[model samples]
Target: MATFSTRYSRLRDNVEEEPNSSAFDEIIMKQEQIIRDQDEDLELVGRSVNTLKHMSTKIGDELNEQAVMLDDLGNEMDTVDSKLNNVMKKIAKLTHMDDGKCTCSQT
Candidate 1:
């Protein structure tokens, strides 16, 4: 009868230890899942950053192109201004007489 009691007590202790071990395993599984989720989030963020960088680089390239075009336009405007000044000087010379008087004399 004493041997039977000892076996029963050992079985009870074994059953109690099983729940504790199971709880530890559950905690480890949850921790591993959390780590995996965090790794995925970080990868997504890295991809987003790369996309933003590409867009910003494209924008910068477009801005440079626009700046070059603006400089070309400015040079063209200067040429036009020079031509206009020449035309004005010619008109002024035609209107002026050698005596610095008006060509349409008063009767």
Candidate 2:
């Protein structure tokens, strides 16, 4: 029992004399640098997300404007088609009256 107690006291004294090992301090410093690098990477990712959001908004606005313009163009095409149909009807009426006959008199 005395030998065991002496060995325990010697171990305790050695542990107390060297509280902070050089290897342990280096490991802690490396961990802190890693944490700082991770924080910077997260900030950059957040900025990239914001930039993408802004670009998406701009693209959506442009697409909406294009849709409106296409709608206006469709309306204009309908108007032109109606006008052409009217002109065709008038031509058909005149052709029916003529019936391949010349009604001009010699003066």
Candidate 3:
């Protein structure tokens, strides 16, 4: 895409070819350093993701344990409620008896 007028400028003609090789080497070195830094950053991100996964798994296990304990507590409360209802029914029957007197005969 070089136009004839732009391709042959005075500044381009005056530059020496010796520095181009050294400049290209420096550019390659800088690119390599940038890639190494990117690799390190990706490794750090991977470690962080693993840590987050481990923490979430532990929290899930703890939640499951708590859910089981809550279920047991609910079952115990139901049992207590059933016992209390039976006691209440017995008290009601006793109260309905003839003014708290029993109908037993004397020997």
Candidate 4:
């Protein structure tokens, strides 16, 4: 039977000249399980990042659309303001004409 220290040394180093097979196999299995768990964690993080990226893109698109709509509304309001100014000018001219006209005198 191998000494306790010899068995411990074999377990610690994977490149042992005379590996105790059961201990090596156990170590490999545990290491594989740890690697799998790490892979799963990395995959979860990747998915989360992708989701956030998509949401950010969506938000940016919506903001762009809103800005365009605001620009259009501003342009339309300017047109309406110009038309209103013309109507006011016409009304002022009509008022001046009325003031100059003589009132109908009763016979």
Report the C-alpha lDDT of model 3 over 14-102, residue by residue, as the tens digit.
Answer: 46555687789999999999999999999999999999999999999999999999999999999999999999998777666868775
The weakest ten consecutive residues by lDDT in model 4 span: 5-14
Each candidate structure's TM-score, on Cα atoms with residue i matched to residue i, is 0.67, 0.67, 0.68, 0.57
Q: What is the lDDT of residue 50 in candidate 1?
A: 100
lDDT of 1 at 28: 96
Backbone clash pairs for candidate 3 read none
Best by TM-score: 3
Q: Each model's C-alpha lDDT?
A: 0.89, 0.87, 0.89, 0.89
Question: Tens digits of per-residue lDDT for model 4 on 1-107?
Answer: 87565434345554767768898999999999999999999999999999999999999999999999999999999999999999999777766676596444358
Tens digit per residue, CA lDDT, model 1, 29-85: 999999999999999999999999999999999999999999999999999999999
As a whole number from 0 to 100, the lDDT of residue 103 in candidate 3 is: 53
The better-scoring model by lDDT among 1 and 2 is 1
Evaluated against the true structure, the overall lDDT of model 2 is: 0.87
Q: Lowest-lDDT window of 10 residues in candidate 3?
A: 9-18
Candidate 2 wrong stretches, greater than 4 Å: 1-19, 102-107
RMSD of each: 11.9, 8.3, 6.2, 10.4
